[model samples]
Target chain A: MSTLTSHRTRPPAQPETLRARRLPAYAAPAIAVAALALAAAIVYGAGIGGPVLVIVLGALLYLVGLFAAANAVEGRRAARNRTWSALIHSAFVLAVLPLVSVVWTLVSKGAQRLDADFFLTSMNNIGARDPNGGAYHAIIGTLEQVGIAVLITVPLGLLCAIYIVEYGRGKFAFAIRFFVDVMTGIPSIVSGLFVLAFWVLIVSPWFNDGRPSFSGFAAALALAVLMLPTIVRSTEEMLRLVPAPLREGAYALGVPKWKTILRVVLPTALPGIVTGVMLSIARAAGETAPVLLIAGGGAAINFNPFENNQSSLSLYVYQQAGSASKYAPDRAWTAALTLVALVLILTIAAKLLARRNRLSR
Target chain B: MGETPHRSADAGTGGTRVTQSHEWPAGASARVAEAPVSTRSPDGSGLGGGGALPRARAFGAERAFHGLTLAAGTTVLVIIVAIAIFLIAKAIPALRANTASFWTFEGWFPNDNPPTFGIGALAFGTVLTAVLALVMAVPVAMGIALYLSHYAPRRLGNALGFLIDLLAAVPSVVFGLWGRDYLIGPVTDFSGWLNKYFGWIPIFGGDGPYGNSILLGSLVLAIMVLPIITSLTREVFLQTPTANEEAALALGATRWEMLRTAVLPYGRPGIIAAVMLGLGRALGETIALALTLGATYSISFNLLESGGNTIAANIANRFAEANDTGRGALIASGLVLFAITLIVNIIARAIIYRRREFTESAA
Candidate 1:
């Protein structure tokens, strides 16, 4: 209300005049005292064990001090604003705290053994007694499995999205949308069970019997199933956004519709397509259930998708963490952190690529 | 037609001006007639000409490409359908062979001489935990979405949204570990208080050690799903038509009233979609449930003390250890979960479709 009054009284060019008229420039010390008290409470909480009652009291006092400070500085309205802002900041902090704690725990514990050997050697010959085992085979399996999944899903998903957005008219589009919606919500374990039951029991019962069973191809197929829906939805939106004017211009030059969609539309929408694909990749990279069910944990480093047992980072984390050995479990924490780091790296890479493309073009 | 005069007072100079001799409105029709007909058609000989050959060839190629794209897309659909059919077929013999009821039985001791399995406990636990999560999550999630969309400063909101998105993308296993190491310890005390105060209610009537219980599992799930609902609701609310909000404000409505009247109604379908999306994540969640729910199979309604198990968690826990029959039983349970999610998504799509129709008709 005071702001409105001052705005009406003051000229437009002199905005500072309104601030000077409405707000008294005082009460800075109250804010400082509140901050000091908050700092003291944090330090005391860090140093000493307190009764829940005392802690609650401290928190209440801290909030009251903040309210009083804001009220002194600006008035009841500013105090309310400060309170709401504090609540929002608290909510944001609450949302982030668990994640921060998890990452902190992983990095601190994982940093102990993330040496050169951790990435180079394999745990194939290492026993439960050994403390220096590594996960090279698992790392390799993760990459190959994810790469194969990407290879299978990208073109299929992209083409399907193109069909839906560009060529789809009515009934066929509705059917496709329904199926995609159904597929999106299917459980991860269902995909796993689907692959396992189909491949192991029904399709080729004898395929993995004589041979050591782990195969990257099986894992890749499962992840591909999980990734397809996300890819299609995202890519379809990107393709749909490619302006009709570009296609019409191409048509005016006697270019084929397919050629126009391919040459002009896709090029315009390439960055979004890449972003969608990368998001799928990021999602697929961390999946543990389907990979576990399909890709039987292999010990040795086998990069070939068709070959015997290969392990992924997720499976490796599960394997080690679930094992009886203390050292392997510790290493599992490290491996888990390494996997998180790898996924984060890929995400950052995708963002950078998208950014570069956007800027350059 | 190409021989028509190209010059007009307006076109030649690229300006709209009236001459002393020509009144503007009167000359409009004259200018339209004086425009060259050749400029109207970009194609040579505009229509019904031998030049149509190139156009026909382009159309043919396009048609073939369309066919190819359709075939390619159908291949993906075929793969998905084939996988589902193959699994159902493989599991059918086991499902049919069992003489006992598969869903009513509370036990899931598949490793015994004779497998006795049912989805009673799993289904109960799944629904209970997911409901618990939804109850805890929806208000805070919507609040955050509203704050970020309407209240927070733009830069702050964007930064917060990015941070939340990153948090949402954190792996489930990490959340599981975090829940076990951090949340469980703190939440146990809170759960104990709930039991103490609300024990009259059957849901909270349990013993003190609620550390690895359904309530804790739900809490973990709630935290994990918060970002998803928040981001989605933010988008939905952001897409609310601006004119409606302005109209409400113009009619002497408060900010809250404007949001209640204009923004939320416009975003109803989106909110449903967002909720379903969160529910989908909650339904399929495994690792977090595994860590917090303690993998106990019980049919109790009590949430605070007893350990519970969701279908996804049960399958993950038992799949590798189960023999053929046991695996089949778990797969059957998975089939039930699949049907539930499929139904949910279908309903969500229907709501979105109805929203589209409603908006179009209203317009």
Candidate 2:
């Protein structure tokens, strides 16, 4: 046994232990800075382009330089890995650019008109030349339309989700789930067109002296269609997250199935449901095509959604953007900022609620 | 009949019966012990007597609630069917009135005396722009997704991912306004550069006019879709089993190689689904494309030229002034758009469903 052990050679001296030599922590940032400087010099010296061009050229140069340097220092596989890592990180940076630009532009352009008058008054008497028009009327129209849409969709969407999570079985349930997914992908404009064809052209003519009229109610209907799938899908996810043991526990105590769902399941999923509803509401409030098609953007403060023309903030932005008035641009920007603010607030709130739910659970 | 004596014994000595049952012969005695309680209280009421318990009222509220939820579920199906039916109904009259072939003709003159219109150019532009957007978006989105899923620190990844989702919530009209007002200048400059450098390429070949071209529209679309693809693909990549990933790494694979062997293969279906969903979104985008495209009716491949039109954009552009037949024509175009998006979405869903089954079975 000792002779056999001695005869087994010592594994060829271990071959440098497969050393994985990593680049220093400062390597990437140093390389990026040098690349940018080189790109800027070349671009400026050649009189080729501006800051945007320099940035693009710099990013390209950085990627190439990173690959080459890594390939030279490390072997090909490690270089390839580093190159991909750099590409991925840069890709993220690239995406952040547009978001930053968009938010910056919105704020800088929108703040010029963010006054109390912009929120309190309507655009009714403000002429094209006047820069005094506000989105108050549009804001009101948006609230009423979104409110009515929420009223119609929430109960229906909740019940559908409950049905799917609690009692769903076989092909019918599958079909419902599938169609709900399909409906979620329906374009906002098509929903508007559906409302226009069914309600405005066919049904509303009966009420409005043989003439079709646009109303906020039509917009609400369209928004409801848009909101339904989102709410249903979200609520379904939240409901499914409810544990089976909770339901069984209630059942063991002589509680009926419906009561178990109502008392145990729904209350547990309530925060998530609210999050979904808020998200859907945010989406509905930002929709322009449907509102433009059905609400018939009007300047006046129309309180009754069922009656005449009403303009939403989204429609107001679109109209103001398209209008020939020079002052209209400011109003459009301001209205857009308002719309975005409203949407972002709702989205952030929903996300916060969702996060809280995850922690508590 | 053989179990009756055992059942009576079980009932007489409830606590002791449980202990004795374990000691008894394997199957028959245990069955006999359990049978009387199960048979007597089918609903598991736990009542001791053999006498029947009084039944409650026929669960009227439960039945009512079930019916209400079922009706709500049914309503979604009804709404989908109604949309298609109503669209077809509205489109038929305009189609009948068309002097031109709806499939082949390029120009839209639906308001003319004979009312000639077609979806040829609109459909072409729609497909072209959406394809271009996906081509530009998918790679970068995959990269971003990989960064979030595999590269960034967990907390940072989560925060950045949340920010990206908020980007999705930004309204299309806001994108439209920004694209038209702010992005047009930079896009025009880039188009000129492309024309100067890559004029031999058919897509980049165009004359002086460049702003509001298909290139601009597609760029906006790419940005708009970037967040969606990134978020979805990140989710999919994160779902790649750590075991598979670690196995590749343990086999002396580089980070990229490990991802290629494990994460990429696992996420192929998900990536395809995400791309198709993005395509559907780009196809049906109305206001953004409406504002970005030059609103010309041509099926040219010169993306840098200021000439492109999509069905959704055409409908949004012409709907306000459309007469009876023109409205029908626009509705017909919208129906066409709807059909295209429906096909894309269904294909995406199919891929997702199949992948789900595969994963579930594997798991």
Candidate 3:
């Protein structure tokens, strides 16, 4: 008892100290600046590079400097950690460069033709020398094609999701799910080819009196095929997220299974479903190959989707970019910008709606 | 532990009650007459209520809904089968008409009399460009993914991740446009520099006129697939067990060492899956390659030369002016692309599914 008391009464021992050494916080920034100076001197003074080269060389120098300095100061392991950290950060920066350039180029070049004339008029009568053509018809075509695709895909996809989530069992359901995954990876261009073969080559020829004529409706068919898997997968996820307790509660209230799913599950998952639908729509709208293949892109303003050829913004961009005329590139840029804007708007709105969805949380 | 015997006893009683109800009269009216008595009691209640409940009257509606949904699900399968069948049906005629050795020939002249065309060059370019793009993209994508998942602060990571997702949402056609007009100059200059510096290497040994080359197309493809790989790998990295990470850190391992010891080993399958998925995308990319590649037809290995073509790009470029035979030939090429991507995706899915069991067990 005396020994225990003496030990308990002894003063607290000194805290153990860590032997690991760390560099100062500002060391990184200082080395970065030094590396930049060295790289600038080597690249610019030699007249062999530009800003991009300087940045690249500077990043290399910084990595080397960081490793050397950290190794001398903080030892090998810390040096490796620091080097890897710098590399990872620079990797992100390197990726951001192309993305930023893409966006900046679109805005700068696309803004040149962002005018009322470019928006309101069709490219029907625009000559090779004319700079006043617009994607009015293409915009209309994209909307109609995408709108029709949405109308076809949403119900089918929703029902498929319902089937998979609520009623699915055993191998048939597994096959459906597996194929859906496969279908999701089907190339957009291949989807276009499918439609071109099935619809434009075979089915639409019946409607066109033995001649295979392209129509906006054909484009809609291709887009529908592309949009189906995306919608089904997303809606399936959303449906799965609808809690089991909710279904159990509905069942406890004597609601039939179908009614429970229709009244309870669908309502709970609706916002998420809409978000998925909108996302698929955005993806479908940006498709160029299918529209290029089956729609037989027209410059004229033909509003009838089932009757005649129609242009889409993507198709228009592709067309204008390939055209020999000098004015076409500007039009291509503007149309590309328009298509991107449309897609981005839809995607953003869908994301926002998804965020608001209770089921998502 | 206390409830187990009680629950099992209740289940046994319930099973006996279900058997007793099955022994009841088969008539609906009789079952309905029996429902109230069984429902009123605490024991054996709801056993007869199974078939006699009002909800049973809606069975027809339930079956109809189920059938409808089942039909919708089946349509997905039908669509895939139809794609393969229709593509073959169209391609057969074109294949039969080909006079040239379709496997070895490099030129595409399906429009000519007797129609000589081949997928040799296109397939070569497709695989080459896609492989090269993956080579360029995978390391950097992994780096960015690691940064997002482990390196960056949480809020910064979230914001940057959102930005990367938005980058993915940017359309392919827009990327094509940018690559054609804006990126071409820099890529051309870079190509020249590579040719000048690395001219001794056969692949880099090229003369002038080096803008729309395999290098340019692969660069654009790399950019396009970077976000996909990064996002996927980031998710995988984020899922690294905190216990494993802490174990490594507790061993006095530095961050990089911890990643190498803990995170990477666990995330290898996921990384491969992501890379293969990216490869799939790069293989099937259309407009971007169409706009960027020089559209040449040869099995060239020169990365700095302005000569490369892919199956999808060739289809997109030639589909507009293709005749019956030409369209069929292009569709044939599309068939080849479809098969390639299918294999890639199947392998990716297999990897994911294999890993899924491990992860599920681990969790």
Candidate 4:
């Protein structure tokens, strides 16, 4: 055979295939199906209490089967790759389940109380048993509280950002940036407690007849505290993005520095600043704990934010959810829906604006 | 006019140059350079080439504005310190009369004659629920992050990423209601199944009633935290250099292998920071856990039981009905929560600080 091969200019055949072997795509699905079927039989026949067991067992069994089949048919490397892919896909599926389920439940249950009456009439004279009451007062409370928060937070946050990006340097700047980061992590409840201690307890007593009182203004202060750090951080990011050439050009134009900042820097960064402010507004608007603590949720309408109790949509939801009345759940669900809608709208607007800015650039 | 150039030029030097313009090295030359422009425009406001020269004031609108911003910036630090001081000042009276150990007692009946409250149970529940949430969330978040950053097609990745971000915007109270009503049934069933199969473990050890269990609360918390962890980790994973990934691929590495060698190693610190941030949020979460947890203030390790309570939740639940002493107790507990979150966030910030160039430049 060697002599004939030499004469024919050919060599002996190799025993193995040249390329690395790969299992067919169908192999994984087949194994997974087999594993899942076996899992169902074991779980159901073994008197498992619920579907959770079945799903968990099926997933585990499928993973094992895929890895084992791939290892045997292909190799360890391919098995690892397949396992990771399966894990990643399953993780995404798992996350999507809760997200979709929550949204679906909100829409389905919230629709029960999504009437015009729900928006128009306040619970001014309604009894506990009445279902005709609305969130009109709560809406007003939220708007004013959140509006005040935006007012306080925007100027201070923008100024803090300006100090950081324009005038700040060294330890003081570092300190400001660091504190802003720390402030962002403050609990909303803690912020509420702060306002409770400082504003409602200490300051309000000084104003009132030596009695601690709750008010929408106190809630606004707490929300402002919560919102300030967020606005500062986001505004700082946007301000940093303003190109240096623009600032230098303004300087070269002999424009006063403050005028340049007010006219050029601010106008250039206004859209992003507005986006940050709106997002903070949405966040402040949904704060339940702070308003609950400070405003002391009201049953009747209260237009004045300066004094007396007020209800926000979030506080209304919490109060209603905890009430023993039959119709309270519907109101609670609808309030939740409205809050979600409000927040999503603001968030969507901000994202769209950011996207527009990006596209135009 | 004389002081403006000195202040603007190399303001970092910290010199008192209001009266002495020639003190700055660049100030003299800058004034010299401006001589021609002023001469050409003799009617300009500065000298007006007229009799009345502008006052050489020590500060102007620019300096005042700078000082104003600096003061505004310092308000963050002031507010933070004020929160701590006022909370302590308020909490001291409650601590002075506590019948129970503040750190060790397991009950929270603070409205009594000699007020009795302790953070042990609340703190335990807070840490347990937050840790459980982290355990449940971090791996799934990482997987989603990796998928979005590396595996999925770009357009699909962008869409899913955007949707995930929208998940972050959903308020906690909405999540609370959803969890309490809709998620309760499935979670109860799941907890029952877990107890049946894994009852030996303390975490899964519970009998029939399991609707508002720690498992449910932690799962809800996980959902609340998922978007944050996912987005942060996605940002980090995306920042992994393309060259390193390509090098791994050139070495005949599989996609998973490349990720292991390149992406994961690069994103490790960032992932840690993200996880810490998620942990912080989970700890501070109030309304969601307040609704989902059964509000049972018992210090036990059984997660499958219909019993759990957190400090923030306790504050929200008890504050409305609390007496003055009770309010103080709640504030004290809030102080504890504040400390925990502060430590976590500081650690996170420190981790991110080390990589500041990476983050700031990306901004």
For TM-score, the strongest prediction is 4
Docking class of 1: incorrect
**Over 4 Å off, model 1:** A1-90, A206-214, A352-361, B1-51, B54-63, B97-99, B196-200, B240-258, B360-363
Model 3 residue A222 distance off true place after TM-score fit, in angstroms: 0.6
Candidate 4 regions with alpha-carbon error over 4 angstroms: A1-18, A358-361, B1-56, B357-363
**lDDT of each residue in A182-211, candidate 1, tens digit only:** 687777777877877766555444665543
Candidate 3 lDDT tens digits, A280-338: 88888888888988898988999999988999999999999999999999999999899
Candidate 4: CAPRI quality band: medium
lDDT tens readout by residue for model 3, B1-363: 011121212322442232223333332333235233333444544444332343223235556787899999999999999999999999999999999988889999999998999999999999999999999999999999999989999999988987787777777888888888888999899988878778999999979689999999999999989988998899889889999999999998989999999999889888988888788789989999999999999998999889899999999988767889999999999999999999888878878888878877976
lDDT tens digits, residue span A111-147, model 4: 9999999999887787787878889999999998998
- The residue pairs found clashing in candidate 3 are none
Task: Give, for candidate 3 chain B, the lowest lDDT window spanning 10 residues.
Answer: B1-10
- Looking at chain B only, the TM-scores across the models are 0.81, 0.84, 0.85, 0.84
- The numbered model that scores best in DockQ is 4
Of candidate 4 chain A, the 10-residue stretch with the lowest lDDT total is A10-19
DockQ for model 3? 0.48
Candidate 2 regions off by >4 Å? A1-55, A358-361, B1-59
RMSD of 1: 10.1
- TM for every model, in the order presented, reads 0.80, 0.88, 0.89, 0.90
